[model samples]
Target chain A: MRRRLDMQLDELNELLTHMGELCQVAINKATKALKNGDVSQAKKVQKADMKIDQIEKDIESLCMKMLLEQQPVARDLRQVSAALKMITDMERIGDQTSDIAEIVISENITESMELVELTQMAEAAGKMVKDSVRAYVNQDLSLTRKVIEADDEVDRMFVENKKELVEYIAKDKGKHGERAMDLIMVAKYLERIGDHATNIAEWVEYSITGIRIEGN
Target chain B: MRRRLDMQLDELNELLTHMGELCQVAINKATKALKNGDVSQAKKVQKADMKIDQIEKDIESLCMKMLLEQQPVARDLRQVSAALKMITDMERIGDQTSDIAEIVISENITESMELVELTQMAEAAGKMVKDSVRAYVNQDLSLTRKVIEADDEVDRMFVENKKELVEYIAKDKGKHGERAMDLIMVAKYLERIGDHATNIAEWVEYSITGIRIEGN
Candidate 1:
């Protein structure tokens, strides 16, 4: 029974890692589409979200099965339940990535927009997602802490991006207000993705130590 | 065993209903703050969020206890798990309500901004939250469907609000662009609150029918 539970836990870790990788790909695709004004890549990101959603369902079913079959106790139960919680956050990351792609496609955002802070925010958020999943799979407490701390950076970038976009609109005399608003929305989405990553890290900590942080 | 489980489930229902009421109050306070430019009310919303978060923790502990002590299976297990999922969305509703209030406080938005569509969106989203919780507590499928359908109206209102805000900025020659952008963010937050409510309704449906909806 112990070995079987370990096997199932390993499988759960793999599926979660795969889900995290897909989110990273979607974020990367969306960011690239925004950079190059590539509508096709944006379309691909939206299309790939279906796979992410499907994987979430798969993970859910597995968690349910583990709960009903293994009746895992203590740390093992925490690991399974935590997977259930983590997938929700991972799924939202996929949704937000698709949302960014949709904005890029619909807004027809050109590569000409000065998106320095936005790009940094995307990269930072994407890394957090990756690191959070790594922490979960490796059960690395330090890496989980790092992911949580990194959210402050993404948030700072979001605020800085908002300020810069507002200044850009002010200078442009509102000629580009709609476009700047779209960019701001995109930044907001990235910030949310960072938040979901932080949530995933917190869940990872809970699974490892059986201690849920307050106000998460 | 069955009677004990029933008693525990009733307790869970009471806790959830209480949490839902707190979220409604937060939403009402935020909306009032926006409409009246009441920074103090906005601050109240922020302070009240701690209570919402605490209630979510309470619900989580109860669910874990039910799962462990009762060891519920089949439909009973589904109900317990659904409660687990619903509280996450409920907690998010509280967070989004607080976010709207924060925007109101920081942006110092006045009631004279021609915010017809935003006001409409807030009312509609709040109703969806209310109806979704009612549906869950009553196990009413039709009401769950109603909440799901209401999301379309909120989505429509969001689009209309965005278009109107953009036009308003254009008319003001970029003078009110900052304020318009802030309103747009507020609308987006309300729209997300509607989405979370829809998710809760879906979980309620799952708890009732054991048929989890796809692509929630």
Candidate 2:
């Protein structure tokens, strides 16, 4: 029974890794849609969200099975529960990327500088999400810490983008104000994606180290 | 040992209720300060925040003890984890409220109708929070639904206030513009409080029913 339980843990770990990969793919495609102005690519992202949602449901069902059939105790329960919570944040990050795709569908990006910056932000957040899940799988406390530290940069960029966009609207006086607002919101969405990734990283830390890191 | 375990659970329940009361107090005091332009009261809310932080830490420690000593599985684990997650959002609401209090201190709100509307918005949010926590404590799913429904009203009020504030700024630029911005921030803060309370109520439902409520 113990060996079977370990096998189940291994399977769950692999599923988590697969979920991380799918999330990365969604983020990369969303950013590609923004860069190439590819409406189809953006639409592809929207359609692919159903798969991400399905994976979340699968993970939840796995967690439920582990709880009911395996009856994991101590750190194992924490691990499964943390996986359940971490997937929630991952799915949210995917949703935020879709929001960015919708923004791409709305406004014309005559210039590439803003789109480039936003893509870099999204890429940074995507990398954080990947590293956090990897760390959770490996139980590497130090890697989780790095992911947590990365959130500060995300927040700073978000604030800077907002201030600049607001200033642009103030100066232009309704000229491209809507577009600028959309840009600002896209940045805001990326920043929140970073936050959810940080939440994932913190969950990793807690499942291993039993510490809750928030607001600091 | 069973008696001790039950006692610990009771203590935890009491502590959670205490935290809920503190959140309500913070919301009330912060709104009152913003409405009355009471610097002293604002300062008091700021000062009391440290105490809230201490309570959060204390609760976390209790949760850690319960998890380690009692080896709680499934439902009990979910309860403690949800409380931990809820505390993070509750503390954020408090910080945002403090931000509003500071804005009132820094910027005068002498004659802005938007400020008045924001205060009412905060009151609506506070009522939702109070009701939701009550529902969670009682396991009253119907009351929880009511709390969730009230969130739409708070969100509508926020939008109405934001639209009117924008009009106020556009019509009379630089006249009460700063105060209008402050009022807008306060409204955003209260809306966020409603969001967090909704999350807590949703968790309560899941704890009872094993069902997930998306974005509740």
**Per-candidate DockQ vs. reference:** 0.20, 0.08
Candidate 1: where are CA atoms >4 Å away? A108-112, B1-26, B35-117, B124-180, B191-216
Q: State residue A118's C-alpha deviation in candidate 2, in Å.
A: 2.7
Q: lDDT of all predictions, in order shown?
A: 0.86, 0.75
Least lDDT summed over 10 consecutive residues: which range in candidate 2 chain A?
Answer: A173-182
TM for every model, in the order presented, reads: 0.69, 0.56
Compared with the true structure, what per-residue lDDT tens digits does model 2 show for residues B1-216? 466666876787777777777778888899888878888899888866767778888988998898889887777767777677767666666666776676677666565243677777878888877776676567688988887888889888877876665555555545644454556667766877888888877877776677777863
Q: Categorize the docking of model 2.
A: incorrect
lDDT of 1 at A87: 94
**Each candidate's clash count:** 0, 0
> Which regions in candidate 2 have their CA more than 4 angstroms from the true location?
A32-40, A105-113, A214-216, B1-216
Report the lDDT of model 2 for residue B188: 63
